[model samples]
Target: MFSSIKKTTQKLINLGFQDDHANDVNQKHVVNFSYLVFCFGCFLLMAMSLIPFIPIVFFVSFICICLAFIGLRCNYLGHYARAQLLMPILKMAQVTLLTLFYFGSESGFHFLLLHVIAYSFIVFRADQGFTKGIIVGVSSLLFLMCAFLSLKGVYLTESKQNLLLVSVFFFIAIYFSVVINLVMSRLKSANQYLRVLAEKDELTGLSNRRKVLADAVNIFADSVINRESCVFAIVDLDHFKKINDTYGHEAGDFVLTKVAGKMQSVIRPIDKVGRYGGEEFIILMPKTRLPQAELVMEHLRQTIASLVIETDKGIIIPVTISIGLAPISPEVTRYEEILAAADKGLYAAKRNGRNRVAVSPDFQDGN
Candidate 1:
């Protein structure tokens, strides 16, 4: 029975202190809701602590419960940051209240301060104000001094050993908080690096095929789920194989890298471009129609054809890309199918002697 209770307690700790991450605001709001619910449960536990002391305990619990409920409701109403910030403050207040219940700053429940430290690390993050750090330092020092005064018989404390132990544990809590924060900061840095690497094509610094496909899937899903619109385009370099065969692989790499840079210069931030495969690229245009997507692709094609790259050997490498364009509609059930339709248009561009934008006839008819 005791072991079962221990397991349940561990699960609750995991739910309360874990870091929940997301790329969307809605998901972050959900995380804030989950945290507030945990705070509600904490308030319940605090109320039970004062069971024999009726009215006062009921009032405190009622206030806390109200705060938690308000925070949860505000999440749906779009006050995400406020909801996130309030829960931690509520937790810190609870810890502060526990500290006041014991004399000489000695209480076994003082270990609960660890939750405050963890919450600050998670919520405030590195870029936030240092006020949390200041609070922690001042409170810890005040508790330590109180413990010392109690040992010197200047204050009340029936057990010197317990007070000393609690004081020592408080300092230990500080040490653990610092260490954990440092480690988590490192992990967050490493995570950011990994994310960048995953999204970029290492050789040319363009978006990779995998990243592009992921974006397409997400964009398509969002479009269908929300009844939004988007367009997909494929660009393939004209005579790319001949260039590789004529100028050697190094020259080919230089040409591809330069072309990617030119494309990046002209595209909008909301538009995504990726190296789809050898000598080919794909783009996703959210909230764009077929005509708009075609115009954008035409501009990109002309820009690529006009730009001339001068090599170290004074060789001017002239290049152009053939583009196939297709807009996603409600009828298209899969991203891959949309891509295939674009590929068909791209093949037509290649057949029509390249360096131009070709729209899928199938898409036009459906539209």
Candidate 2:
């Protein structure tokens, strides 16, 4: 009975081991749950604070609580995008306006209003800032005026002149918030673009060696649980220095770009190709086996051998590459071991000839 139960448990474990797919799904669920809990907490805080304000505050708090609960539940139950989008709209424009009305714009809870504009700034960064600015400016203006009127006891039945003044202030606040968020969003995008360019090789759109190594360390961590096959191939341009001397550095750059493009074309969607150094490029193939990886490298070799790069002298240069394939199974532990093996294979390919494919002996038995 013990042996039978152990076997059954092993089967169950296998079912749960969906490799990388399971990890992605579980992490997303956790994020969704956390968002729900946060929204619920905000609602609870508002309700507790306003419960003592007779029937008027009590009724308003009750409605806010219901809306919050609905948003929380929806977010928790797989309607993630809908919940994220709808909750801010409901909270900021609907219940939030009411909250501002009771507490005033200068109330301690005024910071909550910033969340709406901030979320918009991040998610809608691509949208026209002028348009978003107008929308937020208008929304803030309306919110501030309503709050002012509510505090002055002219909210429900207001004197016309007083209402006009309140409306003007509301528009001003909205306009200011929109302008601030738009500027912030533009700055954020510019920084991100600059960072990407800094880490990338200009000639070949591949990551520089520094970025490649950093990304490799992160990828290795995921390999522990996923146990998926990872193949690392080191490719060197044969006679690269000769190409540079014979044709010039411009020709060499042309060869490099063409090689990088060929590597990108042959590799699978999940694979990554990066410029490792002067004439060396690294190809990282995730969840791929030796035979599948070899097929890709072979294609890269042939593609490079066939490429016609246009140089500054108006000469079309032809180039070739030598590739070394090193694969690690789930059983492998050390990242360095995989890299060392690939390097050895690359050396072997260089020794054999300028244009050939070499496979590491360590990964041969799939041990």
Top-scoring candidate (lDDT): 1
What is the C-alpha lDDT profile of model 1 across 139-218, one tens digit per residue? Answer: 56544544444323223345643654565465446545544554565468668878988899987798899999999999
Error of 1 at 96 (Å): 35
Candidate 1 deviant stretches above 4 angstroms: 1-172
Candidates in order have lDDT scores of 0.69, 0.64
lDDT of 2 by residue, 1-367 (tens): 9999756643432232231322233323222332343345445545544534334545655665577566556654656555445544654554355444554443323344554565455433344476447546755765565555445332232343344345435543654564455446546666677899888988899998878877676666666668767788899999989999998887788788877887788778887778988999888877777888888888888888888777767887778889888887665677767778888888888898769888876676643
lDDT of 2: 0.64
Clashing pairs in 2: 137-174, 137-175, 141-170, 141-171
How far in Å is the alpha carbon of 106 misplaced in model 2? Answer: 21
Full-model lDDT, candidate 1: 0.69
